[model samples]
Target: MYATIGIIVYVLLYTLINRKQINQHSRKKWIYFSLAICAGAAMLLLSDSSVGWLTKYLNNTIGDLTSVVISE
Candidate 1:
């Protein structure tokens, strides 16, 4: 649930970011800054979720692969 919400939030943030004009060399740092903020916020939103629960999303096989890759 939370994971899905987080993913949705991330996608929304991505769309919002892409619609803006932030592709200048002078604002290069803002690109990373915005992405970091979006990722952090989305992760925090999904922090209550369990890994197993999250892996049950649409991309079941891919989710399992990602879980293994991120399992530290």
Candidate 2:
């Protein structure tokens, strides 16, 4: 709800601010913008799970490296 509204507002403001550039390179600009939006959405959806998994993996890897270094 709020997120959707925020996104809409951002797009509106962004378009207004970049109207000249957007018009000059409309097709390419819009395609890239859409791709960025898709990527952002993907990250937003996956951030929580990905962050937890990455943190755990890194902690284990670092712990193993530290133990090996200390032992040597």
| Among all candidates shown, the one with the greatest lDDT | 2
Off by over 4 Å in 2: 1-8, 22-47, 70-72
- The true-versus-predicted C-alpha distance at residue 42 of model 1, in Å, is 1.1
Steric clash pairs (candidate 1): none
Q: What overall lDDT goes with each candidate model?
A: 0.66, 0.69
Residue pairs clashing, model 2: none
TM-score of each: 0.33, 0.39
Among all windows of ten consecutive residues in candidate 1, which has the lowest summed lDDT?
A: 43-52
State residue 65's C-alpha deviation in candidate 2, in Å. 1.3
54, model 2: CA deviation in Å? 2.3
Model 2 steric clash total: 0
